[model samples]
Target: MGIISMIIIGLIAGAIARLLVPGKENFGWIGTILLGIVGGYVGGTLGSMVFAPHKFTVQPPVNHAFLGAIVGAVILLVIYKFVRARV
Candidate 1:
């Protein structure tokens, strides 16, 4: 999928993840959407590079993409927290 498609997928995945993960305040619509878009891109890039032998397609498997999106969001959130703590 292209960046646009990935962003869409990520947005959906991220929102779902945020809803499901629980425990803290949600990122709101705009932040959640942005996180998802970025998560999709990061997840796709990392997954493809690490799993190069699979001939990773731009159109990633939905499960993998979803997993990637969630992971990316978690990573982003963690980093955000870390940076915020230092500020």
Candidate 2:
């Protein structure tokens, strides 16, 4: 996939993830996009470790990007909440 498409997907995934997780996220649109991009990377890394083993990049055939993004976003959100509470 292209960088543009990935970014778009990331934005959408982040928004969806934020919605799925009930809480007040202190981030704007840009932050959401960044969150999603990071989430995608995190998801891709974890998925690769679990499913592909040797591979690092997830291809279109697997199309685990969205799922991975959601999982990653949830994780990040949780961490963010925890840290924010502490601070």
Candidate 3:
């Protein structure tokens, strides 16, 4: 997928992730969107590392991409909360 496609997917994935996780975040919608984009990158990278050899990539089908994004977002959210709590 292209940058634009990734952004769109990230937006949706980010929104879904935000809804899935219950808690007050430090950022707003734009932050969520950016988080999603970063999540997409992180997820894609990790997924590639874990599943690339097995060829279980999340590129072709949209579902995998969405799933990956959610996973990534959740991870980021957790980290964010952890760090925020420390500050």
TM-scores of the models, in the given order?
0.67, 0.81, 0.78
**How would you encode candidate 2's per-residue C-alpha lDDT over 2-87 as one tens digit per residue?**
98987898899899889988889879998899889899888878887888555657555655678998788878888888998899
Q: Which portions of model 2 show Cα errors greater than 4 Å?
A: 53-62
RMSD of each: 3.8, 3.7, 3.1
Give a tens-digit lDDT track for model 1, residues 37-82: 7876677788888876565557654677778777777677667767
lDDT of 1: 0.73
lDDT of 2: 0.84
Q: What is the C-alpha lDDT of each candidate?
A: 0.73, 0.84, 0.80
Candidate 3 residue 26 Cα shift, in angstroms, is 3.8
Prediction 3 global C-alpha lDDT = 0.80
Error of 2 at 76 (Å): 0.9
Per-residue alpha-carbon lDDT of candidate 3 for residues 1-87, written as tens digits (9 for 90 to 100): 888887788888788878887888767777878989888777877898888554655556556667888889878888888898899
C-alpha lDDT of residue 72 in model 2: 88
For candidate 1, what is the total of clashing residue pairs? 2
